[model samples]
Target: MLIKFDVTNEEGDRLKMQYGQKVASKAFKMAALDAFDLYHKNQELHEVIDSQRTEIRRLRNIIEQARSSAAQLLEKTGQGDLIDG
Candidate 1:
């Protein structure tokens, strides 16, 4: 009996496993579990990246508001609008 298994790694390279005489089901199951773990870790990384992006955007908005308010306060106080000074 001959069995051919198609497996691919992170680099998208196809890995071929041949079972000529006997195959262990446990080994195959372990490989599948490892692949699942890799997928789960990738998902977690994507979530972290999304959270950081949201935080960056929130901080940028706050900075913009602070700059605008500072300009308005300077104008109201007749501080000569020293934007660069």
Candidate 2:
């Protein structure tokens, strides 16, 4: 399908208006492309954050295990009082 429209300045010059609209349209397209690129990069960053969260949880579990083992050792050595809990 094809559609067309005519616009004119106060001096009745259509060429000037057409040129201005063309320039404006180009700028709008460029801006839209930049926005899309930024959205894509944001999504990538979110994935990285999710992976880092998983890694932090795993490290926390390891630390808890070490603490439990140390407390058990103190009890066997008759120094359980050294452990707070």
What are the lDDT figures for the candidates, one per model? 0.67, 0.69
Query: For residues 1-85, could you state the per-residue lDDT of candidate 1 as single tens digits?
Result: 4545564442122211422213444445545667889899999999999999999999999999998998889889888548758
In angstroms, the error of model 1 at 55 is 0.8
lDDT of 1 at 80: 51
Evaluated against the true structure, the overall lDDT of model 1 is 0.67
TM-score, candidate number 1:
0.60
TM-score, candidate 2, is 0.60
- Model 1 residue 56 lDDT score: 100
Clashes of 2: 0
Q: For model 2, state the Cα shift of residue 7 in Å.
A: 22
Provide the global lDDT of candidate 2 against the true structure. 0.69
How high is the lDDT of residue 55 in model 1? 100
Give per-candidate clash totals: 0, 0
